[model samples]
Target: MTTEVIKKPPTWFWVVSVIALLWNLMGVGSYLMDAYVSIEQLEAMSQEMRELYEGRPAWVTACFAVAVFGGTLASIALLLRKKWARPVFIISLIAAIAQFTHWLFMTNSVEVYGTGVYIMPILVIAFGVYLVLFAKKGIANGWLK
Candidate 1:
């Protein structure tokens, strides 16, 4: 009888996986807070931030939900060695791009928050793109089933 021994990912894979999970969890927390904060809490923000938050359209909020939720689920799928991670990560990247587009072009966020606000969005988009490619590579290399 032949026993097939499955291959395990390298050390960096586990490290990256855990870090990705933690990172996406933070995004989920931010999304939850943004979506469900109390009226009083929302009122406590600086006028610029409050205005920005209040001005967000339903579609923008929905994009935010998709970005965070998709990223979070993709992380889980990656850890579980599921092939579905690729598509989920791609979804996350697209949602993230949409969110960033809204913030960068559709809103006054940059004018209100100064150029520093752009940095995070850029980072998020870059990370989103990286994760999509990462998941694709994982699948192609047999790190993900």
Candidate 2:
């Protein structure tokens, strides 16, 4: 009998994994800050975030944090080729869409910050594509089995 050892994932996979790690770490830190920070600090952070988002609601900000947490876990699982990562990634994509929708429809303002404000839509689209591609890759690599 012969045994075969599979090769490692592609370099891009590792690169994505690193990005995911950063996302997850940031997500966790935000939650911690939201919980432990002083009211003034929270307000300051919220103000900064609002400026970036053009007056998006506070609930949207919280949901965005949840999505980041999901994405971070999914990304880590992807590194280990865990089966649940695909579903988590899908959930993250849906959450991202929901987050974007909050910005597009529910948000009270239309005054985009600057020329680069269009990047928000582009980021959502990129996240959607990333979710699809990584989900397929996860399945192909036996991560979803």
Candidate 3:
């Protein structure tokens, strides 16, 4: 019987994986908050913000859930040094792209929240892409099994 060997990942790999997990956990928190904002919390928002939040389409919210949830799972997989992290990251990236596409193009988020709103979404997308590439590299380098 043939056997496959897995190499030990470098320290930086562990560091990055932990950071990714924390980041995606924050994303999951954001998604949860958005999904279950209380009436008091909603009322606390400015009119523009409240309207924007309430007006978001269900599909966009669904994408948000998938993106954050998928990324969180992928991060966990990465921490476990699982090769499946790559595809999970890819799925998360796709969902992130879809969610941001609605926010950037299908809505007046920029007009309502100004250009400042662009920063977080851009960062989210970039990080998602980085994670995908990182997972792929881990697989290629035999760091993931």
Candidate 4:
């Protein structure tokens, strides 16, 4: 039997992978701060916002954990040239969607935070989908193994 050899990816692949890693690291930092937000910080929020935060379901919190942590792990996997990055990124996207769903449906986030809050969620979904597709493209093009 013959074995297949793959060519090295171009400079853009490394560039994108590093950017993805840094982006996900920011998500991780955001999650840590959200999880550990101080009482003073909580009190500083508007009453509606405070209620939204204090009343969040535990499962939604878990989804936030899964979304950021999974994305970070997927970014690391991508940089390491691991084929597992695709599925892990897909999982991260699903968790992100779930978190967004909670914000859009289970709570009055829009009513409270107004239209500006939509930007971050939209970016989160876009970036999550982009990373998953990027990983898939990497695998298909033999940049990942």
Best by TM-score: 4
Tens digit per residue, CA lDDT, model 2, 109-143? 34544445457656755865676687677567744
| Span of ten consecutive residues with least summed lDDT in model 2 | 108-117
lDDT ranking, high to low: 3, 4, 1, 2
lDDT by residue for model 3 (42-121), tens: 98999988888989889899999989999999999998989999999999899999999999888888998899989998
TM-score per candidate, chains pooled = 0.91, 0.65, 0.95, 0.96
Candidate 1 is scored at a TM of: 0.91
Tens-place lDDT digits, model 4, residues 6-79: 65988999999999989888989999999999999998999999999999999888988999899999999988
Sequence-dependent TM-score of model 4? 0.96
What are the RMSDs of all candidates, in order? 2.8, 4.9, 1.1, 1.1
TM-score winner between candidates 2 and 4: 4
Off by over 4 Å in 1: 1-6
| Top candidate by lDDT | 3
Give the higher-lDDT candidate: 1 or 2.
1
For model 3 the local lDDT of residue 87 reads: 93
Candidate number with the higher lDDT (1 or 4) = 4
